[model samples]
Target: MKIIAYLDAGRIALGVVTSPTHFIAVADVAPDLPTDLIEILEREDGMDRLREATAGRTGDRLLADVTLKPFLHRPNAMWALALNFKSHIAETGLQTNPDFPHLFLRTEASYVGAGEPIFAPPYSVARAFDYEGELGVIIGKPGRDIPVERALEHVAGYTCLNEGSVREYQMHNRQFGLGKNFEASGSYGPWLMTPDEFGDPARHSVLTRINGVVRQRAPLDDMLIDVAHTVSYLSRGYRLRPGDLIAMGTPGALKPQPDDLEGQDLSRQFGPFPTPGLVHMRAGDVVEIEIDGLGVLRNSVITDPAFEGDL
Candidate 1:
């Protein structure tokens, strides 16, 4: 079933999107979306109840009339992939790293809902905030040393994610988490579609656009490491709980850069040759990431004073 979090009245309400005219009240059947959602994903017979709850509801409440928040406001941890896309490596002029998957972590502090404005923190600290459109896998059950063949079984559903980044901080800091997990930076949601509705994750098309231009496009099949191995490998020594987010990875795209009459730094030139460009978003730009069946997540970029302490 297609589940979405929306603004009902003034408070955030979670509901299922059945059509433009109908929205099943999640509260009427289930307590809350984030907390109660785990039960729905794990229960063998819960899908029917979910369908029954949202079946006949109607009007503005049905469509995404309100804003969408992070599916899991407090995900235990955020796991992300870097350079898993071969095209991303070619565009960035970086050699593919062999051996193990390229992984990184973004904390819950970065969580922001769709339609929410992403905070462009203090200029000095993060001059280049970039975007990485990725397909996020939500693990439904707890498993250890899972086999790749059974990986899809543990999956609860799928959603679209924009893995925003701050180039300067990520590269300069000893650990990238500080720059990667800034408050209100990571925006994703609209809804989480169960595997049955999602079909084959690998067949789905993931596209990212800025303003109205398509910047990146790739299929889930392009991923060097598929979902199952990723989950099982990561869980080798750690426990992957119900709400953990596995961000597959992003493809190649053109990004913003410092200009100097095209003669400043030869290393910084963007000449059709693929090199990672900092796709910085200004205060008014709208960024959209769409995954075929899952749904679309759009957010406006905004500037805000730097926030101190942890978000």
Candidate 2:
């Protein structure tokens, strides 16, 4: 079943989306939910409990009339995957760093819900803000040193991740984390599909669209390190708590290349402008990140802080 966290009217809620026009309210089955989505994921057999709770009440509600919030609330942290795509390395003209699993962090505060507005930081601290559409791995269980063979067992499911970056802050810090973790920048989810629905995370299709134009397309097999490998590797040192998001880095065609600079004369050699990096977000731009099975997250960019409401 496809599960979604939505903001209907003015209240936030969890829903079971069965089809375009049908769904069942989790509250109708198990009313007065005390815990958030992350907490629901951490509990033992929470998936089964969610299924059982919503089982007998399917197809009783209409889908079109209601709105969707489509974001995970209060995840522990968002982890980054660098150089996970082999083609990405070749495209950028950089030899693969020997580092097995390059990692970084985006604070929880940076998250924005699907259909929500992405704020442009007022200070103009970053001129080259870029987008990296990625497949998000949502961990369901707490584990330490999880074996590679059983890594998938710890995953709750997958969601769409728009990994926005500020090239200025990122390169200046000499660390990827601080640059990527700007408040209200990253966007996630319309729903968190269960593993049963998201099947074979290792092999799937990913596409990125800017203003309804397709820009990047690749297969999950192209990943140098797949989801299972990332989960197992990450669990080795960091104790992956429930609701921790693991972004399985962007693939080829999205990374910056020299060819994009062929037509126009660049003013400066370094910094945001002439780099031919990923698409830079601005006011009124709608960016869409879609996975083959999971739903699409449609969001618009706006600078006004008034646009944000509790999700």
Candidate 3:
């Protein structure tokens, strides 16, 4: 089941997508079904419930006509991995503990929904604004100390994620820090695809493009730490809850044409970016992250009104 959370006539509703451009309201199918996605997941038979509710039905409404929001109004505990992709680690020349996943937390306020504009940091701040395209794992079943073999049992679905970064602030300290927490810099969604439908995560590729040009492409298997273990690892410390999101770290950026520094400093206290001449996202840029089974998660980059040159 492919689920979407959207706004219709000033009220929030849930829908099941039949195609990239269309969906059927869950309420229209079953008025008594839960309207909240997490509530559905909280039930042990969530997926089964969704299947039975929308059985033999195709979307009658066009998705383009409504407003899409991240399925969660207020996000659940959001965690992300760093240097977890082999290509990313290889390009950055960064090392990590081979046994444990490199983990970090992100605030819910940092994200905007699919099709919404993502704000870039102002020029006065620093110009090294970048994009990290990765996969998102949404937890369905809650658990603690989850074993590796049973890790996937907690997964509800998957979504596309654009983990935007302000490189300058990100490297200012030894941590991801403020650079990652920038409001409206990141994005999630298009829709959540259930596990039974998405099949094997390892078989798909994350393809990212900026203004029609491919900038990042890597197989899901490229991750140094895979999804199941990542879930299992996080469970050792915090209880994984329904709607909790985990972003599998991104792959290395592909060097852009000419590979020439555009005069913006890529240097950090540690070293320069993996792809030094790689172009960074700016206002007016359209970013797209596409995974075959999961629909495209696209956003336009814009400058915050307060940060505009008029100031």
Question: Residue 243 of model 1: what lDDT?
Answer: 66
lDDT (Cα atoms) of all candidates against the true structure? 0.72, 0.73, 0.85
Q: Could you report the Cα RMSD, in angstroms, for every candidate shown?
A: 4.7, 4.3, 2.7
Ten residues in sequence with the least summed lDDT for candidate 1: 256-265
Candidate 2, residue 204: Cα displacement in angstroms equals: 0.8
Worst 10 contiguous positions by lDDT, candidate 3: 262-271
**Candidate ranking (TM-score, best to worst):** 3, 2, 1
Model number with the top TM-score = 3
Sorted on lDDT, highest at the top, how do the candidates line up?
3, 2, 1
* Candidate 3 residue lDDT tens string, 3-71: 999997888799999876788999898787788888888888876878888878878999999989888
Per the 3 Å backbone cut-off, how many clashing residue pairs does candidate 3 have?
0
**Which stretches in model 2 have alpha-carbon errors above 4 Å?**
8-11, 32-35, 60-67, 95-99, 254-277, 304-311
Candidate 1 RMSD to the correct structure = 4.7
Tell me the TM-score of model 2: 0.86
**lDDT, candidate 2, 46-91, per-residue tens:** 7778788876665677756666664466676778887677766765
